[model samples]
Target: MLLAIDVGNTRIKAAVFEANTLFDAFIFVKEEFAEKIEIILQQHPKITTMVVASVGNLDPSAFSSFEKRTKIEFISHKTKFPFQNLYATPNTLGIDRMVLAAGAVLQFPKQNRLIIDAGTCITYDFVDADDRYLGGAISPGITLRYESLHHFTAKLPLLTKSYPENFIGNSTTESMHSGVVNGVISEIDSFIENYKTRYAKFIIILTGGDADFLAKRLKNTIFANSNFLLESLNQTFQYNQK
Candidate 1:
């Protein structure tokens, strides 16, 4: 068994994998990570190797407990990836995005892929058919948009994201919903359109916290999987071994 951990901006998502199949999964806040991992370890002592990918400033001590039982691999720019990274500032690339790009290549090979991860922030990462990690864009995520409005202004109340009934919102809360939700949909669609113009045939893989909410709303066809990063972490682990 393999243990995979993806520490994102807000949460730490961990999974136990038997080869490519997911055995079990759990998520917790960053502060609770060490305790959660301890529980997971107690439950699955057979996990021989662990791979971690983080975009947050997680303390290394949190993972120190795994040293005795599992071989830990924390992904970094130095880590071997399946694809050639062409980003100008390679060192500055987020490990989460790198893992997602690697996941795209592993999941759907020999094709142009655009991976949209909608978590704390929305990130678009592209990997061409030739297996080159071409850079993509990033924008404010659904929650961030709502929070930004409230944080930046005094009167606007902080609202949770929801699917608006119409583009023309009737109420104050609905208007915020319309702007954030529909605006994201439009932004994603526009990115897809622009990518299509450049690449004749490609696949869009949408995965993240808000993937389910945005999947049906998207005009472009996409393969949505919320646990993509974890899966990719496992794949990267296997690839690293080879």
Candidate 2:
């Protein structure tokens, strides 16, 4: 069994994989890292390796205690990926994005892929049919947009994400909702449409904390799996072994 961990900007997501099949999954804050990992390892004693892809501040030393039991592999630019990275600043590419791109290339072979990760920041990554990791765009996510409005403006109140009933918001709160939520949807749809114009055929894979919320809202058809990163981490590890 393999334990795949994704340390994102806000929380840690983990999953146990038996071969390529996911057996169990977990989500917790960094504060509970030690306890949660111990519980997970206890529950799944067969796990012998733990693969991590971190885009956060958590130090690897937190996993020191588990070193005796499970081999630890951290994804970095030096790690062998399934695809050729064509990004101008290859080393600067986030490990999470690289894992996602590798997952796209490994899972959906011989096809163009667009992966949209809507987390702290919405990220767009494209891998062509030739398995080249072409760079994509990044934009503010829903919560960031909400916070931006409140932080930048004098009167705007901080708010959570809410779907607007209409594009033309009736009140201030409704308008903020429409702007933050619908605006992101529009931005995503526009990006997808733009990509469609350049590529005749490609698959769109949406993953991240807000993937489920935006999946139905997106005009373009997409394969939305919030756990794609974790699955990709497992796949990337398996690929490295080969």
Candidate 3:
């Protein structure tokens, strides 16, 4: 059996996979994380492989200690090039982004694909037909944009709700909400239009926190996966074993 983990800025997720099938998965929060991680690993003592992807470079020493306790193979790359090196400086590209796009390419090979992750930040990544992970764009997520406005500025207050009204805003809060969500919707629309012009029959995939929220608003159809990075870790495990 293989255990996969994706560490984001705010949470950590775990999945147990056997025979290329996911058995179970859940999110372990930070408040009582050490106990939760220990319990999860204790129950799955026979796991032979462990794969991980993180938004930021987590201290590998911490993970290494856990792997030593579990007797499982740990896989993580700070600078390893999994796919063709296209970026000018491969070290700057986030491993989470690489895993996410590579997983999509594994699922849908020989096709142009767009992966939009809407979490701490919204990222758009493209994989060309050649299987090269061409880079895309990144923008503030719905919540972060709201929080940034309040945190960075003096007058603006923080917001948690969303607006489904027309583009124009009526009040100060609505004005901010409209600008964030509506602006993203337009941004995605324009991106899709530009993608379609270059590639024929491209597949669009959306993931991360606000994927469902944004998908509901955008007219462009997308395949929504909540555990994209988990699937990517699974794929990465298989790739390394081969």
Candidate 4:
């Protein structure tokens, strides 16, 4: 069994994979990192390897105690990837994005792939048909948009994400909801449309905390899996063994 860990911006997502099939999954904040992971490991004694890809501030040393029992591997720029990265600033690429691109290349061979991760910040990473990693874009997610509105203004109240009853928002809270949710949906659709114009044939993969929420709203066809990063961590580790 393999323990795949994704240390995202706000939370840690961990999963147990029996080969390519996911057995179980978890999500917790950094405060619960040590206790949660310890309990998970104790419960699944078969997990012999823990592979982590961190885009957050959590220290890798948090896994130090488990090193004696399970091999701990951190995915970094030094880790071998399946695709040739074409980003101008190659070293600056996030490990999370790199793993996503690697997952796309390994899972969907010989096809152009665009991965959209919708969490604290929405990120788009594209890998071409020839297995070249071309960098994409990043924008604020729904939560960030809502927080920004509340933070920047005095009267506008902070709100959670909610689909607007109609595009035309009549009230304050309703308008805020419409702007954050619908605006993100529009931005995502626009990005997909723009990509469609450039690439005649390519696959779109959406993953992250808000993936499910936005997936149904997207106009383009997409493979939506919130657990893609964890799965990719497992694949990346398996690839490293070969």
Put down candidate 2 lDDT per residue, 1-242, tens digits, no spaces: 99999999889999999999999999999999999999999999999999999999999899899999999999999999999999999989999999999999999999999999999899999999999999999999889899999999999999988889889999999999998999899999999999988999999999999999999988888999999999999999999999
Please identify model 1 stretches exceeding 4 Å from their true place.
none
By lDDT, highest first, what's the ranking?
2, 4, 1, 3
The lDDT, on a scale of 0 to 1, for candidate 4 is 0.94
After superposition, candidate 4 runs with Cα above 4 Å error: none
Report the lDDT tens digits of candidate 3 across residue range 1-242.
77887877777788888856888787866554567667777887767667767674455565655755554444445433345647766678787788887788788888888998888888888888788877888887778888889999999999885864757788888899898888888888888889889887889998887777888778888898887778878877687667
- Model 2 compared with the native: what TM-score? 0.97
| Model 3 lDDT, full chain set | 0.77
Give the Cα-based TM-score of candidate 1 against the true structure. Answer: 0.98
Say which candidate scores most in TM-score: 4
TM-score to true structure, per model: 0.98, 0.97, 0.88, 0.98
Residue pairs with backbone atoms closer than 3 Å in model 2 (clashes): none
> For residues 73-92, could you state the per-residue lDDT of candidate 4 as single tens digits?
99999999999999999999
Residue runs of model 2 more than 4 Å from their true location after superposition: none
User: For residue 60, what is the lDDT in candidate 2?
Assistant: 89
For model 1, what is the alpha-carbon lDDT of residue 34? Answer: 76
For model 1, the local distance difference test gives 0.93
